[model samples]
Target: MQVFPYSIVAIFFIHHAVGLSFGSIFNDLKDTFSYYSSSLISEQCDKRWIPENITGLEDDLEKYLHGQDLAAEIIISALRSHLKKTYRKKPLVFTLHGWMGGGKGYTADFILKNWFLKGGRSKFVRKYFARKGYTADFILKNWFLKGGRSKFVRKYFARK
Candidate 1:
């Protein structure tokens, strides 16, 4: 009779062990399936985080702009305001006449340093939004380089 009680205890132990092992296996399988369907890797990309390198608005366009959000907001606002008041259409050949050093370049650097989510051309970046209707404005013409050297102008500066 004592031996019979020991057999029952052994059966209870076996049942608990089998139930726990099976439950764990089922849970693991469920997790693996969920990971793939969620467009993420299970072990590889669990704790994904965005790097601190975006720049557009000092506030909005967070993912696309990777720098000082406030500066971009001011610049974009200023550019829009300037364009709104005296917007005009001119030929491709014009002058940056008085203004130089190119905030456009600095702007591009700022954007590139802060925003680039993926690989792309400059136009696809911050400039192309106005590039279509305003290509004639501010005089930054796109030029092809011959052997990647000559900056595509038909005439060179007098000193050069």
Candidate 2:
């Protein structure tokens, strides 16, 4: 019998939908070590989130930027200066709301974008959703995929 690698164990822990089958843990397998060069937070995929040219923690999205408040004063001040120099040049007013059957890509045709937060994978919520007859795929569409660009567009594009 051979011992399984810790890296595979971590991947299973993070992505496994159900408690691991005993077979996976006990099965004979080669152990390989895999580590990331970046912090877990920075490992997030490049998502269409927030304003353009605004990569780091600076604007209203500052709340979610990892280590923003703990950053040094010099860095914070530099970020603030950058925002000031570029704020007006970029779109500022933004709105978020719910709409029904609105395809995410269609909204992007009008320049709006989607924000996919990772919280759609909460275990408590997952159980709740399952009891309500939703699988992981259904839960994802219900939570993040079915975004709408709001009814305000209706008023603006209303028939005369």
Candidate 3:
């Protein structure tokens, strides 16, 4: 008779303890999930594509690319016109060709840094360098096709 009462008391205490533990576990899980979801939302918001700053780009070009007024003017005007249009049939492309040490690479780097939020470090920017004896198609097939598609891609072919 006394044992029966003691057994009931023990069972009640055990049940209450288990219920409290389970409640704490659930609350902890809820907190973790909310933190994870909020972080994901913030990361997605940060990943949005930022627009180019044409005025700032022009200033940088004029300041850094001295004696290249003609080239800078042409590039800036073309980019401004292209960006102004809401609808575009195709992507804008630029081909820079000149003798070695003519600032082709510098111009490309500057344009990328000015155009993108993260500049050359961004995942959206891709660069492919062509080695000697590698044709354009071969390079495109092997290098470009293997990698995931990016918003901007630059290909540099070495002069034979």
Candidate 4:
């Protein structure tokens, strides 16, 4: 007669004791591994930057932003084209310039709400403004002149 190893004997007894066949045990392990691997992949990936609703964004831009039809259309088209790529060499940057009451900030806020999962409250999104004490001159002198744009560009647009 052939002698069975301790592990083989233990496995045999455990299999019978647990009412599970070798195939079932292997299948269970495979399922568990698959679940854990997928969870790990999701955790490691950063997908917050992807826009969630492009069509809704386009519609909202058109409906809410009065007298800015061309701007809305251009923004939607540019965003759609940029986001369709599998790999991006650089982040898409939009410079919204107009009169003080031209709804630039409103448009930005709207886009942010539609793009991010947490909308404007997302931790990945940062908003810098020239508030009460911080005037435009102060910001220009401190931030724009002192390589702040470079730092901002590196953090958001550059490859890690």
Candidate 5:
């Protein structure tokens, strides 16, 4: 019958479409599970470093440099306010602008060491230094522009 041929074609098309959709659904589930698991592990590994006396932080910072009391005060105040907040807020972007040998990097080190348990070695902090090979264009195109981790990036970067 003519109807038999049409039914067979329709069934074949539907079966292939359903199979493709299920494959995509499986991949989606896998990605979601991996993302959540990694996030949970990250949260659990975050070890906090809270000094016994808060005043010690200021004293420790003073040991390295001289005549930056105003800058130190501002930084301390900002840190205090950040610590007091319970919920997550927007990320704090700090731009330590100064000439070479002006103690910008030193100040950053001191801040991180006092603020976190592992200090500069903490996993939470990602330091990206501008050097000869890692030019701005490379970062803009490959790192920032790519946004998040994807198959294309993983392949390009030679990562898993």
Candidate 6:
């Protein structure tokens, strides 16, 4: 028998109509010793999430984020009207700019959790950490070569 080592395990919540919630764990095993470069890891199909869970989300954002009411409101409004037919035509882009320890990351996390169906684990979301050891060239190379932008755009947003 072949032994497979699990490298990535992702859990997703499936809400059923019967008011029962279940968790799904997807275990993906890959061969790390191979000479191949940039092998496929874990990927989730992109899906839209309704922003009907706004009340709880607003409360959480208010509690966790201080002096960021305007930012929180903007994010929430964008999410709420993202799926509506009477919204803007272009894709919405949110930029959270701040110095270190200025709660930018925290606010971004809050937005992701509330706006996305699966929180930070949503397939529609992609996070890039701009820390030391990761330069623009390296980031672009990974984004292009590792099938990040092309594959995702083709698979998820190719239709509309």
Give a tens-digit lDDT track for model 6, residues 1-160. 2222222111122223344433222211122323122322334232334233667778888898888888889878876776464545465567677677877777767666665566667565567766566666875775556665544321111100
As for candidate 6, its clashing pairs are: none
In candidate 3, which residue ranges exceed 4 Å CA deviation?
1-48, 131-134, 142-144, 147-160
In model 5, the Cα lDDT at residue 141 comes to 75
Ranking by TM-score: 3, 4, 5, 6, 1, 2
Q: Each model's C-alpha lDDT?
A: 0.36, 0.32, 0.63, 0.62, 0.54, 0.54
Model 1, 1-160: lDDT tens digits are: 1223345445545665755776665555565456555633221212131111432433344444454466556655554454355434431221112224424444454433333333123222223323234433322343222221232211111100
- For residues 93-116, could you state the per-residue lDDT of candidate 4 as single tens digits? 777767777887788777777776
lDDT of 4 at 151: 37
Task: Pick the winner on TM-score between candidates 2 and 3.
Answer: 3
Off by over 4 Å in 6: 1-52, 86-90, 131-139, 150-160
**Which 10-residue window in model 6 sums to the lowest lDDT?**
151-160
For candidate 3, the lDDT comes to 0.63
Lowest-sum lDDT 10-residue window in model 2: 151-160
lDDT of 3 by residue, 36-110 (tens): 567444422132333477888898898899777888999999889987887776667777767777777777777
Misplaced by over 4 Å in model 5 are: 1-54, 131-160
- Higher-ranked by lDDT: 2 or 3: 3
Model 3 is weakest, by summed lDDT over 10 consecutive residues, at: 151-160
For candidate 6, the per-residue lDDT at 125 reads: 59
